[model samples]
Target: MEKTLSVQGMSCGHCKMSVEGALKDLDGVSAAEVNLEAGSVDVTYDSEKVTVDAMIDAIEEQGYEVS
Candidate 1:
């Protein structure tokens, strides 16, 4: 499934990559795209292996906030 999450604290390409990398590293995540300008992250992942809450936590662990 795909999910779009509102993310904050992304100010540059590096920040975007950080969020993307975090999400991609998760077992169920197939892809992740972070838009710094829109402050959002679009991710394609397996719902059976991962949850939205886990995605939020991964983003937050990279110093970003998900709303």
Candidate 2:
């Protein structure tokens, strides 16, 4: 499944990398693409192996706010 999450506190390339890296590190995630200008991320993952809440937690752990 795929999801687009609205995120905040991203300001540059590193923020984009940080958000993408955190999401991609999840076991079920296949891909994570960040739109820095839009303050959002598009994530592709297996729903059976992961949950949206978990993904949100991961992003939060990286110091980002997922709404």
Candidate 3:
């Protein structure tokens, strides 16, 4: 499944990398693309292996707010 999450507090390359890395590190996540300007992330993952709540937690753990 794919999900687009609205994230806040991303302002630089490091922020983008962090969020992407966190998401991609998940077992089910195949891809994570962050649009810094849009403050959003597009994630592709297997719903059976991971849940959206987990993704949100990952992003939050990276210090970004995912809503």
Candidate 4:
């Protein structure tokens, strides 16, 4: 499944990569694209293994807020 999360506080490429890396590290995540300009994250993963709440937590762990 695919999920798009509205993330705040991403100001640079580093922040984008941080979010991407964190999400991709999760077991079922296949792809994570962070658009700094839009402050959004596009994620593709297995919903059965990873939940939206977990994804939010991963984004938060990277110092970003998901809405």
Report every candidate's CA lDDT: 0.94, 0.95, 0.95, 0.92
C-alpha lDDT of residue 30 in model 4: 99
TM-score of predicted structure 1:
0.96
Decoy 4 TM-score against native: 0.96
* Model 2 C-alpha lDDT per residue in residues 1-67, reported as the tens digit of each score: 9999999999999999998999899999999999988999999999999999999999999999989
- TM-scores of the candidates are 0.96, 0.97, 0.97, 0.96
* lDDT (Cα, tens digit) per residue for candidate 3, span 1-67: 8899999999999999999999999999999999999999999999999999999999999998987
Ten contiguous residues with the weakest lDDT in model 3: 58-67
What pairs collide in candidate 1?
none
lDDT of 4 by residue, 1-67 (tens): 9989999999998998899999999999999998888889999999889998999998899888889
In model 1, what is the error at residue 59, expressed in angstroms? Answer: 0.4
Q: After superposing candidate 4, which stretches have Cα over 4 Å from the reference? A: none
The deviation in Å at residue 48 for candidate 4 is 1.0
Top lDDT model = 3
Q: Candidate 2 — worst ten consecutive residues by lDDT sum?
A: 16-25
Each prediction's RMSD to truth:
0.6, 0.5, 0.5, 0.6
